[model samples]
Target: MTTTADPPQPDDAGAPETDPPAPPAGAEDPATSFTRQRATRWLEPHLLLRMSLRAVVSAILGEYNDKRELMGEIEADGFLDLSTPDGDLWIDYVADLGDGFAATYAVATLLSRPELEVAPQGGTTHSTRQGRLLVLGGDECYPAAHVDEYENRLVGPYRAALPRKDPDAPCLQAVPGNHDWYDGLTAFMRTFCQGRWIGGWRSRQARSYFATKLSAGWWLWGVDIQFDTYLDEAQLSYFRRIAEELRPGDAVLLCTGKPSWVAATDDDVEAYATLDFFEREVIHPRHARVRLALTGDRHHYSRYGASDGAQKITAGGGGAFLSATHHLPETIHVPPPRSRARSKSRSTTYQRCDVYPEAGDSRRLSRGILRLPFATPTFAALLGGVYALLTLAVGAALRDPAHGLVEDVHAMAAALRGADVGRLAGGLADSVAAFLLCAVVIGGAVAFTRDASRRRGRITGLVHGLLHLTLLIVVIRGATWLTAGMPGTWSLALVVPLVFAVGGILAAELVALYLLVVDRLFGINSNELFAGQAIPDRRNFLRLRLQPDGTLTVYPIGVRRVPRDWDLRPGWVPGDRERFAPVDGIVAPFLIEEPIPIPRTAPGTAA
Candidate 1:
């Protein structure tokens, strides 16, 4: 093998210097920079070898698995035109997917319609044939920003959508979600820059939360509530500045990842803690002429009112995991002079607002009305009833052979034989006991069926069902033991009860398993499965039963398949239908001008 000689080094004289003076032996080479050293250390043989092997394997196998993803800056081309013919703006609140994968999906959906227009509500608002879209929250990749991850997860999907850039297309504004700061915003800055390096501005790498003037008078402010913590001094000052800049008729849209109030169960402490923080730090200040405060991360849709006359809208339903059904509390603040209170629940929906320069009638202008469904309580009750009945039936069938139906019959026959007077007397008592036991079973079944028909939730139905099943098993076993011929020893008497207990346990287990499957895999509550068919097409209306207090107690109607045009008047007493809102414009509040008696029957008129 032949080796090439090293290149000659030039000295101060511009000639090759032989035997140049050597520096301190321990000193590092002056040619090596800190960056080079750091890079070398990071890419040491052990680390590089491991990463390289994994990468090669992934490449060969066509698998690009990595937790950290870098969704590159979404180019202007990937967005669809949402500008209305008259040019109304389309604002989308999206969040919770790391690496921008989910955000890209939501953006694509909005862009799919090209006929949409973008218009400004405040200032010299103009309507564009192109639809303008604004992203409310969650624009960063999750966990950490790895360049390759962003490319594959975020950029790839966005490119696939091929968003268009309309000369009048709505401007895009974004707020940083919690994941953006995982690695100190390094990846976010690089990816959002679109291959251009952004210089440091105000100690932030140009990409940290900034506002853009979308329209002449409307200022859209995006705030980054870093790591779920309260706004820092810098961020608070920034918001104040933005607020001060707002004009009287201007619309201010504040965007964040977390909602001010979350719907949660009584047992969930974490959610309540968050709610407390939001109330004190954010909602209390009543800052800005907030047209809308949009948020995500709850994976549901909800709208609440702020004291500032702003609507706090949660738009977290962007095709991620659905959240729990939320129920609004009685104490929840409702806007004064409202005809009806709004329900609080996590819903999957997108909102459209039509704001016209406060022209003519303010009400007619339709200020940011949200069109979404409230999860009906009727459905919950129906599910509860169905699950209870099915589980009870299954439990009965699985009863141990030794203690169930067969044993009861055998004991009854023994008592009737009258072979021995003492035995006959004992058998007679046993027979009566058995009869009462069966009655208990019957009672349980009746309670369960009645509660279920009334459409109680799973918790109530479950209690009734389990009680009935247990009572039924116990009664059957007791009858069997009483009717059987007297055993000489106590040990033999124990057998019958043991058999019954074993059978009952088995039945209970099966019922529990069935319920688990219904809840987890199918998202069906057991009550609904066993309950009778749900009321059809009346999702928006709550079926109320009259109470002594002269108030209406609303019940949910679970059925979605019922025709919207169907009349419930046949079931309603005469004149009851007149009290309800007319079918057209049913969204208006029900005005009770006088005391109207509750209709005993369903409404005869079509709703």
Candidate 2:
């Protein structure tokens, strides 16, 4: 295998090389360290409701205001162009970050460093300098895109990491993801479109999408495919103009928000189809080859290299909750068989080359789903509340409300212990309100299925709902029996809390079991499965070097664990090493694999 070996690491006088100096001693140490935050607990009750509401409102509002179309009217002319004054250049790329502080800052801290010495497998240690250009692949901030969310989650962490201005700061550019589209690109535009400063990095792009000319014959194209929608007319026209600058045999680096190649492998062809159409209509017409495609929506690192040495990589592990990699396809055919006739792009089979966390580790981490209650306490609490309501409804249906509380409990317990199905049915039939409540609970369970859009998903959801209903009946009966000998009003107190606490856990476990079953049987709900676990480790990013000889070397960096505590640097000023330092010391990054080298010309190219 070819490798980009690190050059010798010594000055002419034989002095050992080192990264730039740490923050100056004059910098003050605040009374407290910045408390690190965890990855977004997506299964949390309040967050879920809020996100769902935003998604719905955004969808409805988006119909009237297409941000991409509006972008055309305001976009600046000409593509972003970069020169290689030193005959070589470095670029940093990360995506799917800004969910939590600790993980996001961990990655940011690394990126902000002037240089990193990484120990690659089977190779000598080497120092890689920071990129001159920083490309945020997508999903810059998580949960949703809002002014406050961007500041706290995305900008704040980055500002804290770098925390100072520089004369030669890297240029920042981005492509919007679904989360950024939650606010209909309002927050995204504010953050990236203004050519402002985000930390020491300066934003240069004036639109959600960008095309950059890197070096003599290489280009970086960042497309904004809003919510996996079509290539809007305005965006396409912009790229078409950029295409005019392309020369035959030139190479392009395509950056997109989603790994449409992976989606195509999963039988979702439309996503890749959009990308295919863009390449066929825009890039190919110029006779330029897309040497590599990069993306970051999957929250892990996966690379698929075609026979011609062209590569597609997904490096989403900037932050956010770690997504499972066990389910990724081993190989995929670009332009998938169905969409071939629509484009002149030739078909190529790309095989999965390297993956972070390894498939075995991914499978092992998945078992974390079994700890659902602890992983997502709010979710369990929501279930507990549901169970409490169901129990009260059962009590009202079986016992006389006119009686005292203790007497009612005794009567309800007696009816439940008797296991008299006919009497139970008669009581339920007589109480219209109680019956309706039961119907709603069951209906909710069925509706909660992640894959509810498909028949199997509906069936799985119905099974999950019935399982919760059964657990409710068992918990009510068990709780009443346990409190049988308690004093007056004591059983009432013990029973409700027990149902709420214990019942909630049991119901959540059922959800975990449901996720496991569905994933194993039908290959669905993997997102929900790992989102509940919210693993904070296994984050990664890419550093690419463009040599004057037209050779591109890619370094895949991985962080197995992010620091949880940070020491704040007060009174820090520009040119300072960093504003906050990790308490456990900065985690040294390692190469997930050897640096991949893609030549300017590969097999079956325009040349």
Candidate 3:
């Protein structure tokens, strides 16, 4: 099929600056006006200042986090067998994708890479063969999985990424992620099922889940495992038949959307159990050799191998925020693995791909020798709330000097110095009561929000309230700290930098919270936030090849940001620059896994 120059793209320039219906009029109560105003002050736009401040914030706290990129395992001493047209199957897979133009940039980079694309005269008598298959892991678009988002975010960007179609076009296939199911798979079916062309590629699978025929001995299974899923009876039957149809030496590569065993604060045992079930019932029962299982929910790369001979690979880095490897809790296996499993202690990957020159175990470990406290927003919220109390105390001292809380506190301090035990005890009781009263007032404010009963509404209220409360307190306490001693002493001068540093941290937290509410809560889809505080920022994907010799090689590709000279003018938004484009433009390369030789299976028996 001939491909044309991509048509005009969506222009969000004139579209309403605000969307998702803008919280409806009267949603913001008049009583909360003060809090909203405070929010605006800290989060108001001044791009350069925000950038400068974020640079400082990252420098201070970024080191607190590090990742193991799994590069050596993927690269494996450079024995890539990358000589294309080797009469082998080439598959490029990505998941949780379609965030912005950066994903498109990643697609473009893959298409442009020599290893992924086949050259003329290398294969086929007609000299018209491409060595790659376009596989979508899931989540085609952000916000909701709607038609407009697919066209604007996915289709348009894809067309721009690879403008010309290969004469022998690569087939497109997608496994729907949770976001895709939000709209009942309407957009996904319309785009991928109806034979509609996305750029030059087309989806060939009739159902959401599909098992494709690759080399004679290799088969690929992409299951829907729909939202919070277990494979429905029909899906199970479909796969079971595929299993029955395969020969004895056939090997399987399983692909799903969410990671199986990430020990998140809210780990989904049922979800993992579902995958585990699919393995035991759908695949293992049929006696096919299982080589690798692939998933892409968290936006980073991880590879896990077990003593049971099962390997798990996560390559969610399609185009989302980076996932923090250090913060990820231990992997929790369902049924708790009754035996002594030393899986966690034996991970063979440690090199992270982001900020390449500064990547790798030794460098990152050296940079993050000591932990940085309060790097997360939860800590910021606590500090912010404390700062508020201190400010109220100081203000009361100034406004009503004769009968002020600060005066009472100072009197108590002096009494303690003079051994006035009774007076000190009374002052402490009064202070405790006042603190309780403040908590009640803040809780009332959170409860008063109009949408407090909606999904995550109450949590949002509490988190936001605490965050704002913390924001205010930080400013107040920081000011007080900077001026604790008047001009005569050098203490104030010495404390100035610390005060500014505190201010910077608070500023960073505010910025993070604002984006969280806008991008996730009020916007469209939401990621798993820890204590609803911080959003991880890793975007990545994977490239896999099953050679004729039965060696399976995996390459986990990460897209840190958009490369220089990419045109995002197609679907421009106000915050698009900051969202998709970054100045430092630090990006990591593919974290390769060492190739594994697939073990043969006995006839009608597990491998």
Instruction: Estimate the TM-score of every prediction.
Output: 0.36, 0.89, 0.55
Ranking by TM-score: 2, 3, 1
Predicted candidate 2 versus true structure: per-residue lDDT over 538-577, tens digit per residue = 9999999998877788999999888777776666654465
Over the full model, what C-alpha lDDT does candidate 3 score relative to the true structure? Answer: 0.47
Better of 1 and 2 by TM-score: 2
Q: How far out, in Å, is residue 372 in model 2?
A: 2.3
Top lDDT hit? 2
Name model 1 segments beyond 4 Å from true: 1-92, 97-107, 116-130, 139-145, 163-170, 193-205, 214-217, 248-250, 263-287, 306-309, 326-607
Model 3 TM-score is: 0.55
The lDDT for every candidate, in the order shown, is 0.34, 0.79, 0.47
Cα-based lDDT at residue 451, candidate 2: 62
Query: Could you give candidate 1's per-residue lDDT for residues 1-607 as a string of tens digits?
Result: 1111111221211322332232222132211211110001111225435544644553433223221122212111111122233323333334543332333333333333343222222323222121234353663443234565544544433333332222233433346655455444545555543211111000111234545443323444555655454455555444444444444444445566665333222212233233234333443344323345566654334444433334555554332232322222222322122212232222212222211111122222111111100122232233333333332233233323346565643443333222343432232224444334434444543443322224433444455445544543344344345645654233224433443444444433333443334334433332322111111111111112223222222221111121222122233332121111123222211111111122211233111
Name the runs in model 3 displaced over 4 angstroms: 1-87, 112-131, 263-266, 307-309, 328-335, 338-539, 558-593, 596-607
Model 1 scores a TM of 0.36
Write the residue-wise lDDT of candidate 3 on 313-353 in tens digits. Answer: 77766654444353343344442343233322222222222
- RMSD (Cα, Å) for all candidates, in order, is 23.5, 7.9, 15.4
Worst 10 residues of 3 by lDDT: 34-43
